[model samples]
Target: MKNLLIGTAVLAMTAGAALAQDVVRLGTEGAYPPYNFLDDNGEVAGFERFLGDELCKRAELTCEWVTNDWDSIIPNLVSGNYDAIIAGMSITPEREEVVAFTQNYTPPSPSSYVGTSDGIDPTTAVIAAQTGTIRAAHVSTMEGATLVEFPSPDETVAAVMGGEADLTLADKDFLIPAVEESGGALVFVGDDIPLGGGIGMAFRQSDPELRDKFDAAVQSMKDDGTLNEMILEHLGANSPTF
Candidate 1:
């Protein structure tokens, strides 16, 4: 009887340790480039990939990547589809109410309007924005503009190019490459609009311990200046850093 009780206690302790070290799945939208995206090899790659890996290392946590569509990313997180969101998710009051967020990793970026031609008045033009993004929310508030929603960021750009919409509003970092590749086919149509509090990792409100672990990891990167270097490398020198 004594031996059996000792073996049972040992087993319980081992199980607890295993549960503590369970793999943390980092969720992201694989379509968003320079943030999180699938490479030619179909593996997750880019800035967020690099950042998430480093954070997991610093926190001594086992981690893996999982992709979900942008429209359903938050809902999926809430439903326990993954442990945390490492996609380029901006911190906003509306979002904070649903999921807890780590400190800002990247500084607030300006949202810009891109159109096929210059001098297009964005105030009254038909504007395309990715559905469920802060940019789309902002566009909806524009009194004279018509807001057209698309399921993906690429589709929002296509809406402007295909004449489905006069312009598209999105993160300047994401649009810069598209405009450059367009070879004058696309131009900045209006002033850049700043929105959101910056990008951060998000976890379910129930996972405060997990959130704190990653938050400390993020702060360590910022303190060491590595995060700033990464921001300049992946997002361009013009991007604001920690």
Candidate 2:
């Protein structure tokens, strides 16, 4: 697990990077595989990383990857710890009050649940989700659910694996891969729940210009079919398009 770093120490460094104007800091939680994760070489790798680099390249911007714990991502961005957040962050009205988001690169993904077996009960189950995520917020609203949140998604997975949680909820893209990796250890349970709109790049409220640049790049990718290609490559061809 990564320690939460939300102090001013990182802010100075981030502000300096922003001041440079030539380089755009792309913030992400590297723990979420298939969205953003450390590759075999221990560098940022996965769909969003690939898409982010392409967006920066098309926008004629130099990009730097910055990894941070998910719980404090927004505050750290507001504090100038990074220029923009490119993690698998979903767009929602509540979040709009805090930051501006670029156009979505992927369509809304279904939030699904998984358990050690097929017989889990959502009405009384202790469900694990990553703290500060849309999944956590949505889970909290579930009428009979008991949300057991963790600082990270990996820990949420651990909660289910260790019997600490009866089930866990996450994007189908994430849960499907986890289930496949689990062999017969885990199984999907309950209907797929629709949550937020889609995934977007987040920026400080005052940074509309930066958001616009990314928005344009994302649009270009969609128009040329490159965005769908990337999504299909990582998320399967049946994956939803923007």
Candidate 3:
């Protein structure tokens, strides 16, 4: 009878494992590239794709990619629309109150500055950031400059390009593409300060099991060189670090 009971328990555990292997949906902004963005053909590509693939591999699970607006991704994850979020979000104390984080995937801090003219030094000019974003808080504390808050990064970038705001601040990865796309109308000008010290997978705070699993998978990838390889592939060899 004891052996039969053990057999039943084993079967139940196997069934549970099988149930856990169902389609795990991942959320990304699909707006930021080299991290998570849509290609010309509208297919998902970039660091987020590579990282998500590694996580699914580590967890031995199948996944479906889902595009979401930047602000809605976390709320949707909390609402159970997806299993996890990998949208180049930084781990912060306030965010920790609402969601849990996996291991640090990319290098923690990566900041950059953009100005209308190549001759304008960002540190000495007035800066703008999207309101209600981490970047807004980051730029608001500059010692000798003023921070103009906007509704979006695009607006901040546009302000600089259109000669409204003197500069704009954002994660270097995001800033680079904007600067390049501006065709020298806007130039990057910052002191290469380390901004985000810990980038990680975000999960609802209630989902500790899922968080732990994702965290373990991130650590496994880090141990196996997959994370760094993806970073190098996107950010290049000369990328700044903290």
Candidate 4:
């Protein structure tokens, strides 16, 4: 009888430990606002963060958040540093070769930016954003438009406001804080800008089960208004129409 009781207790303890283990390690560029960003309290807060949290709960698994530089996110995921990526990373056919993608949470929107300068004439000066962003890609192809490539969106905004570049192109989502942080030195060109592709989570090519679980969770969030509430919290009164 004592042996039976001991065996049951051991099994219970083992089961509890297994249940407590985190099932997924989600990586993100915690600097991207409205998508994923760190709050004043040093907690990761954003639309994507909430979605990731919910997905873990829905799948009955533990989820741990990890920070990774945006440029290296995919490589780290591929190397098993994390089980999945929840960055505001866009899903593209190019990336599909290396990793599978969950259904898009943030659909693609046109990349936009604000241009500013004190003394320099916009007609004569070069305006640009960082290299490799869709904005830089588009700006570089314009006739006579010298697109200055900076290291990051923040740098590009500095260049433009400091008269280094006439302007910078960034995702509309990013442009909001950049302008606010710039102390009114910059302004969006117009509200009529057309946007581009959607953003989705990245996973290992061999992990379709995880991807499916995430996709279903996202759909549930979408249907239940959880995703929208998170969007409103991060984006202010004028939340993006998801």
Which structure is stronger by TM-score: 2 or 4? 2
Tens-digit lDDT string for candidate 3 (1-242)? 24333433333333223226478788887876667888899978887897788788888778888887775666676666676788878878766656678877877656777886657766568888766567777777767778887755677888887777888888777788788787767787747667655688886555567678778888887777767777778866655332
C-alpha-based local distance difference test score of model 2: 0.85
TM-score of each candidate?
Answer: 0.91, 0.91, 0.81, 0.78
lDDT of model 2 at residue 236?
79
lDDT for each residue of candidate 2 in 106-157, tens digit (9 for 90 to 100):
9998988899988888878899999988889887988998999999887888
What's the CA error at residue 220 for candidate 3, in Å?
A: 1.4
Give the candidates in order of lDDT, highest first: 1, 2, 3, 4
Q: Candidate 1 residues 158-205, lDDT tens each? A: 999899999999999999999999989999986889999999999776
Between candidates 1 and 3, name the one with more favorable lDDT: 1
Lowest summed lDDT window (length 10), candidate 3:
10-19
Question: How accurate locally is residue 12 in candidate 3, as Cα lDDT from 0 to 100?
Answer: 37
Ten residues in sequence with the least summed lDDT for candidate 1: 10-19
Clashing pairs in 4: 108-197, 108-198, 109-195, 109-196, 110-195, 110-196
- By TM-score, how accurate is candidate 1? 0.91
Task: List candidate 4 segments past 4 Å from native.
Answer: 1-21, 117-125, 237-239
Model 3, residue 3: distance off in Å is 50
